[model samples]
Target: MSDGEELTLADEIVARARIHAREVIDESELAVDLGALEWDVSARARRRAGLCRWHADREVATIVLARRAYERYDWPDFAGIVRHELVHAWEFQQFGESGHGDRFRERAAALEAPRYCEAFARPRYVLRCLAADCDWRAKRHRASKPVKSPDQYRCGGCGGSYEVEHVASGRTWTTASGYGGAKSALGEEW
Candidate 1:
């Protein structure tokens, strides 16, 4: 095949995989009904691909696919990786943190996407971080460590602030801010 033709086919494969990922997420009914989510595809050379983020206030989520991984793996496996990441987004919305703890694992298993932590041992790309209101721009880099606690950043537009902290170990999330709306960024209404 011509180089151009091969590249086009590779691109198509990745595109199809991303669509499958979204389909799986939609079918799970686990993700928040944020109307529509965004998808991005790029090569590993570009550095900032194969990541996903969810913006709570905006009710939007974005997925980034690494171009290299897309070209190397089959569509089903690639889609599986995407679905795995989407689970983090769902967990973040329901709880917080894209951790691989019991709750995250349980939810992922419920969606038929079990944890493949060992897969990360290889030099393969990752679909990382599924949190709302996080602007973790894509880069061709792997996090040296998993995120321990969710971040707390302020919004430039609305001046609203939110913090994502882990509930106790083995505990699920509930909409309770110890100090009421005044102390919680999500507010009492949440």
Candidate 2:
């Protein structure tokens, strides 16, 4: 697509959200109502596709999209996430509250938004079952507590210990060696 023909994700969100907002609550100045709607990208969000937060003090709503989710999903699929967050914004504007309750679900249905986003799949870590006989393993996209401290966890299949490895670097850490040159979780020094 040409640069002129392209809209950044943030711009696309505002344009689509403006139209969707009007549909949810009727107002000629709903444009202005949604002018307070802000868009941001979140690098730390692991599981959720998007978040809608209302700032009571500022009387504004900010929608944050997960950077990994957007990178993995096509625009069409990601549009559903935008719609879901918009439903939250609409609910707050009209009902003074927003959540996964009856009203939110009804509004979400009318907007064709999904109830929940799919799991993030860009795996950065690999968890391997250390039982010599057990071949079970998992690919993880986030460095969650369990993934970071595999020693604290046991494999479900063999009840064996685990080894965590960085996918790209092939750096492996096990209970015996302690990860990151330290003798345990975090590091040997810490």
Candidate 3:
């Protein structure tokens, strides 16, 4: 596609983003642009098709669309993703809130947006059984230290030992130590 064609899509994205932003906090002075929506490919594995990055000092927010993930969805689904991020943008821009807090919920409800986005295809962490013929698998996001060791736990299916594996979700993992978990958290293991 030519540069002009690319700009058209970008323009549409910004226009739509602005519309969604106005839905929550309607302000004529609210200046938004496509400068915020970056095209990224790794958002698929991370399970986020769109992301909103807010800048307090500049009074600007950026929305990133996972190119690969966005391509898989229909126009309606893609628009929903844009709307979802806009809710976040509105929350941050108008109310100075960044999380799914009460104000965010209130605005989200007023906009009639989805409560949550779809989950990632893969879990941040995976647990597999070492014993042969036992197809046991468990998934989780956080792991505390003892949980990383295979000796402390056993698979209920064949009494096999457990092993821990961590997968990169296109983001850095920042934490001190190994991993640990409760039996209840591993509900499917039993």
Clashes found in each candidate (C-alpha, N, C closer than 3 A): 8, 2, 8
Residue 125 CA displacement from its true place in model 3, Å: 3.8
lDDT per residue, candidate 1, 66-124, as tens digits? 66666556655666667676776666566545677887788778767647522321332
TM-score order of candidates, top first: 2, 3, 1
Top candidate (TM-score): 2
Q: List model 3 lDDT by residue over 28-135, tens digit each.
A: 333334444333224334556777777777767677766544557776676667666767775566655577777667655655656566653556666677778999
lDDT of each: 0.51, 0.71, 0.57
Off by over 4 Å in 1: 1-15, 25-27, 32-36, 45-49, 117-190
> Mind sharing the TM-score for model 3?
0.51
TM-score per prediction, in order, is 0.47, 0.54, 0.51
Per-residue lDDT value at 171 in model 2:
72
Residue 156's C-alpha lDDT in candidate 2?
A: 70
Query: Over 4 Å off in model 2, which ranges?
Result: 1-9, 20-36, 40-49, 66-72, 90-110, 119-121, 126-144, 154-163, 169-178, 181-190
Q: In model 1, state the lDDT of residue 97.
A: 52
Q: Write the per-residue lDDT of candidate 2 for residues 6-124, one digit (tens) a residue.
A: 77665655566456556545622222256778878777788778889888778788888887787788866777787788777766666667898887677677667787667666567
Show the lowest summed lDDT stretch of 10 residues, model 1.
Answer: 139-148
